[model samples]
Target chain A: MSKEEKRLEILTAAMRIMHQEGFEGFKMEDIAKEAGVGKGTIYEYFESKNDLFLEMLRFSTEQFITGLENSLATGTDLESKISNLSLFGSKFLSSHLNLVNSNISHLSLPEDSKDQIKRYWEHIYKTIESELAKAIEGGEIKPHIDLKMAASVIIGSLNQYAFKKLYGTGLPPEQIDHQAIARMILQGMQK
Target chain B: MSKEEKRLEILTAAMRIMHQEGFEGFKMEDIAKEAGVGKGTIYEYFESKNDLFLEMLRFSTEQFITGLENSLATGTDLESKISNLSLFGSKFLSSHLNLVNSNISHLSLPEDSKDQIKRYWEHIYKTIESELAKAIEGGEIKPHIDLKMAASVIIGSLNQYAFKKLYGTGLPPEQIDHQAIARMILQGMQK
Candidate 1:
């Protein structure tokens, strides 16, 4: 594998370890062993433990965004498009449940992570916001609705619910039906 | 002062330190100094650092819960009650903003601290949920609204927004406009 390919392989292995062992338990030796790489090879890709962990988080986020963009682009109608976005959120968050959970507790984020998180949600909000605005303009939604608050509320609601399912053991994730949740929110925002 | 009074004095000082310097930066000596008590006095009240910290968190949560219950009891009409709840949320979240921000950071939470967080939030959710059901039954809100989701959504949105504000500097706290936010949320949920 090329150097870049090798680096990606290493990160993938590190993420799996993080998922199974928790971030604190993640060690360089474990990643090296999991990746079938020499400890020296791992260093070539990441300078320190913190650096490797942060990079893993960034990579997961990038992958999510890229996948979201591709999924969103596949639909033509507004309903399908919105459904696609929601599905993307559910499935992606469910799969990367650990990393997302770790974002609040395991990762030592840099100053820039704030911008990255805002942009990430802002992108999701803008996408949904544009659709909601269009629907209102098209008379599909109530014209008087405050689109900004609606967008923030919807994004915040689903994101937080999904997060609780993924991170919070207090409530079992199975009890929450995503379609029911989407319907209630969409209905509340409906014309 | 009696031993109990002195202990309460030490806890009050510890809370201030935790609020200002965060839980990680809190030291027994600093709390003792702030409380104007000898270091040995701290040991008389608490068995360990973990015990002291947990007691502080529990104490603050109790105060918050009590204040909210009082607000709920005082408001008679549904709209006024919901409005009071929103305002209460805005005030409570913002007041403890620093301490909450400190706790969510990856390195900040010790493993033992996790259960305390879960219990605290679950209690808050249940309290809100009960009020939500009462509002729905009393015809204060549209009967069709999902009380559980509404409670979760409102709390989650405010929390996330607060989290963003804490991490995303350059945005002054005044920019948040708590009253405006409360109006937006209550208006959206209004019949």
Candidate 2:
């Protein structure tokens, strides 16, 4: 494999370990074996297990943004488009992504990692913001409201609900009424 | 002071250190000195720094719930009531509370801590749910809507926005225009 490809392979191994074992369960020696690389080779690429984990987080975030772009494009209108976004959120929460994010928070984040987090957030917010702007022009929603605030409402509502479900309600991902959630965000709580 | 009161003093000291220096900066001796207790006394109350921090978290959560109950009760109508809630959320995000929550997330949460988190969420969600029920009765919002979902939507929207602003947009709590946010949740994005 090319040098870059080899690095990618190691990250994938790390991700699997994280999913199966969680943050606390991650073991560098196990990751080296899983990646089919010598333990020394693993160190050559990553300074520490924490470094590899940070890289993996950045990689996954990039993947999420890319995948979101494709799924969002498949929606036929503002309503369906947003519903797709909400469903993706459900799927995201169901995965190890949220857990990983929370687990990494206590780490003394490096400046680059902080910047990456900022970028990840901005990238997602813009995707939602653009969707809202499109809906405005298409008359799916009124143009009078603040687009940023509107976007925040939709994002925050879905984000918190998904997070709470991880512990509070314990709903299965397949059983989540994502369409209703999207509708609620679009239409508000009014009758 | 009573044993319970003495423990509370140590937790408060720990919170101060966390705010000043974050999790990495927390020093047991520093807290003991701040609380006007011997290091031995701290051990008598809590087994370890992690144990002490967890107790501090739970203590703060309880305080939050009690304070919220009072502020939420002050609003005379549904609009004001919900606005009060959102504003409280803004103040909360701006405080050390959100920072403390994130900084502690990676900790291997004990069962008692897990239960505490669940209780905190349920407590908050119920508060919002009760407000919505009253609004429904007052005809401020439609009774046709699913109350639980509606509450989730409101909570999630405010939550994500506050969290993102912590890094994504960097809006000050006072400058957040929370009434508009509350209105958007009540009226939605649809014109």
Q: Which numbered prediction scores highest in lDDT against the true structure? A: 2
lDDT tens readout by residue for model 2, B1-191 = 78888877888888777665555567888888888888888899998876887787887777667656866798887667667777776676556545323223334567787677767767777987888888888888887787778877876677666666654567777777767777888888886
The parts of candidate 2 lying over 4 Å away from their true place are: A1-6, A16-23, A26-39, A99-107, B1-5, B19-39, B99-107
- The lDDT values for all models are 0.62, 0.72
Tell how far residue A183 is off in model 1, in angstroms: 2.8
lDDT of 1 at B182: 47
lDDT of predicted model 2: 0.72
Please list all clashing residue pairs in model 1, or write none if there are none: A105-B106
Best by DockQ: 2
DockQ-based CAPRI category assigned to the predicted complex of candidate 2: medium
Candidate 2: lDDT of B143?
78
Give the alpha carbon lDDT tens digit for every residue of A1-191 in model 2. Answer: 89999999999888777766655567888888889998889888888876887888788888778757875798988777777767777677666445333223334577788777777767877887887788889888998778777777776676566666644567876677778877888788866
What would the TM-score be for candidate 1 when compared with the true structure? 0.72
TM-score of 2: 0.87
Q: Mind giving the per-residue lDDT tens digits that candidate 1 earns over A1-191?
A: 99999999999999877666654457899889999999898888898876887688678877876766765577664445545655666566655533542124212356586456657656655676676777776665556665555665555666666655555643444445655555545554222
Model 2 pairs whose backbones collide: A142-B191, A156-B156, A156-B157, A157-B156, A157-B157
